[model samples]
Target: MRATYPRQDPPRGGVRSWWGKAWQRAVEEAAYSEAELKGGRTAARRGEVGGISVDAGALLAAVREGDDAWTVQVDVPVLDASGRRSLVEVVAAESGRVAALLAGELPHDLVEHAEELGVELLPYGGELAATCTCPHYLAPCPHAIAVLVQTGWLVDVDPLVLFAVRGLDREALLSALHARTADLEEPPARVADLVDDLEIAADAVLRARHLLELLESDAEVPDSLL
Candidate 1:
C-alpha cells in the first residue's frame, strides 16, 4: 500500500532541539552553509532525501523476510549531509537494520549477516527499507518511529556513530582477516636457499675426499718396502 508522511521540520530554537543540533553539526562538518541546511530541510519536507522514496509495501516485505516475523512498512523523510532529501522506507527487523540502512548504505558484513539470517533488504535505491513485524502502518509506526527518532538524536551526538548500529564494524573484521591470511602463506624463500647450500657443501666434501685418495694411491712409493 502507498502512504505519505509530512517531512519533519527542524525545530525553531536553533540547536535547542535534538534534530536542530544534528543539522547544525552536520552543516559544520560538511562545511555547508546554514542556508543549505535550511534548503535541505525544505527539500526533506517535500519528501526527498538522497534522491529516493521508500515504497512502503516493498519495505515491509523485505523486513518480514529478514526478521522471520510480520511487520508493516512506514514512511519518513530524511536529509543527508548534501542537503538533498528523500523518503526513508522503514520496517522493523529483529533490531537495528533499519538504523543501518537509514543512516547510510548497509556495510558488506551487515549485508552478509542479514543474508545469513535469511533477511532480505528491499530495493531502496537511496531510500531506506526497514522491517518490523508490528502491525502499525502510520508514517513512523510507533515502534519504528521511535527507532528513527532516536537515530536522529544520535546523529546529533556524532553523525558517524550510526555506522556501528548498522553493522559495519569494519576495523575488527579486517584486522582478523589480515592476521589469518598472513598465517596461511609460507615463511620465506631464504630457508629453502639455506637448505640447498648445505646439500652442495656436503657433496663437495665427499668429492674432494675421493680425489685425495686417488692421488695418494697414484703416488704410493711406500709399497716398495714390501
Candidate 2:
C-alpha cells in the first residue's frame, strides 16, 4: 500500500522527544548558523513541507517558497538484511505486537522491543543528513530541515516510517513475519480427535460425580472397584 502522511501539528515535545530531538540535534550540528535552524523550524511549523515520500533510506519532500518549489532529500542509511531479519524476528515473537502494527498503530512497547533486539528505529545524535535544491549552501538548508521536521512528525504517527527509511516497508516486514511464523504454527486438530478427547473428559466427570454421590449416601463401596 502507498504510505500516507496526514498533516498534523507536531506531537507533544515535538523537538524534545527522542525522535524529534534527535533529528533537531542532527540538523543543528549540520547547520552553519542558528538563523538557518530557526528559519527551518518556522517552515516546518508553517507546513511548507508536503508530497512527502519516505522510502529507500531517504525522505523526499517538496517545499513551496513564494511560488518557487524546492526539492529536499534526507539521506540516512537503513539496516542491512541481517538487521532487518532480527527486527522481524522480534515482531514475530509477539503476535499481538505484529497485529497492532499491521492495524496502523505504533505501540511504544514495540519500539522498546525493537531496541532490545538491537534495532534502532530512530536516528540518533549525528545520523541525519540532507540536501535541498534551494539557493542556500548549507547541507540541510531551511527547506531540507523543514522536510526533516515534518518527517519526525510522520514518525510519531507511524513508527513504520522509520522502518521505511531503513529500507523495510510495512508490507515487506509483515511478509517476513508471516514467513517466520508459518512453520511455528501447529496444524489444526482433527474432528475425531477433538470429539474423543471431549468424550473422555465427560466420562471422567460423570464417574467423579457418581463417587461423590455414593460417599454422601454412606454406601458401602465394592473392594474390587475401590
Candidate 3:
C-alpha cells in the first residue's frame, strides 16, 4: 500500500514515536551538513514531496523544489527469513504489542527486543541506501532527504511501512502474524503420546486379526460386523 505524506500535523508524537526516532536516526547518520538536513526536513514538512510509491525494499518519490523537480529513490533493506521470524516472535510474544502495531503504533519495547535479536525495524543509514537525480554530490540531495524524512511520517500513519522498507510488505507481515496466531491457537501434538497411540492401534489390529482367524474356523463371519 502507498502512504502519502500527511498534509496535517503529525499525531503529536514527534521523536518520541517509534518511527520518528527511526527517521531521526537515519537523518542524523547522513554526512549532510545541519543546514542541508534542516532544508530537507523543511521540504518534507511543507509537503513538497509527492507521488510517493512504496514497494518491497524501496520507496520512490517526486520532490519539488521551486520549479525544479527531482526523483528520489530510497533503497530499504528487506529482512531475511531469520530476521522476519525474529520480528514476528518478538511481536507475537505480547498481545498488547500486537494490538499496538495493528493500530499503527510501534511498541517501544518490541522494537528494542527486535534490535537485540539483530532485526532492524527502523531505517539505519547503513540499511537506507539512497540516491537522487539532483546534481548534488551527497548521496541524498535535499529532495531525497525530504522523502526519507517523509518515510518516517508514513511509518507513523502505518506501522507496516516499517516492514515494507525492512523487506516484508504489510500483507506478508500480517500473514506471518496469522501463522503465529494459528500456531498459538493450535496445540502441538506430543511425540510420545502419538507413538503410544500408534502402538495401541497396532495391538488392536493384531487382536482383530487373531479374532478373525478364530471366527473363520469356528463360524461364518457376520456381514454386519464387516
Q: What TM-score, over all chains together, does every model reach?
A: 0.24, 0.69, 0.72
Clash pairs (backbone) in predicted model 3: 78-167
Name model 1 segments beyond 4 Å from true: 1-126, 165-167, 173-226
lDDT tens digits, residue span 56-102, model 3 = 78888888888988888988778888998888789767656655655
**lDDT head-to-head 1 vs 2, winner:** 2
Candidate 2 vs candidate 3, TM-score winner? 3
How accurate locally is residue 191 in candidate 2, as Cα lDDT from 0 to 100? 29
Q: Candidate 3: misplaced stretches above 4 Å?
A: 1-16, 184-226
lDDT of 1 by residue, 30-138 (tens): 3224453344344333323221122322222212222343333433233331211011111222244334333333444553554455443221212333445656443
Report the alpha-carbon TM-score of model 1 versus the true structure. Answer: 0.24
**Residue 115: error of model 1 in Å?**
26
Worst 10 residues of 1 by lDDT: 81-90
lDDT of 2 by residue, 13-126 (tens): 454445545555666776667777788889888877777887767777888787998988888888888889888877656546654554345566767888887888767635
The predicted structure with the larger lDDT, 1 or 3, is 3
Cand. 1 Cα-lDDT:
0.34
The RMSD of every model to the true structure, in order and in angstroms, is 29.8, 19.1, 21.0
Where is model 2 more than 4 Å wrong at Cα?
1-32, 103-109, 188-226
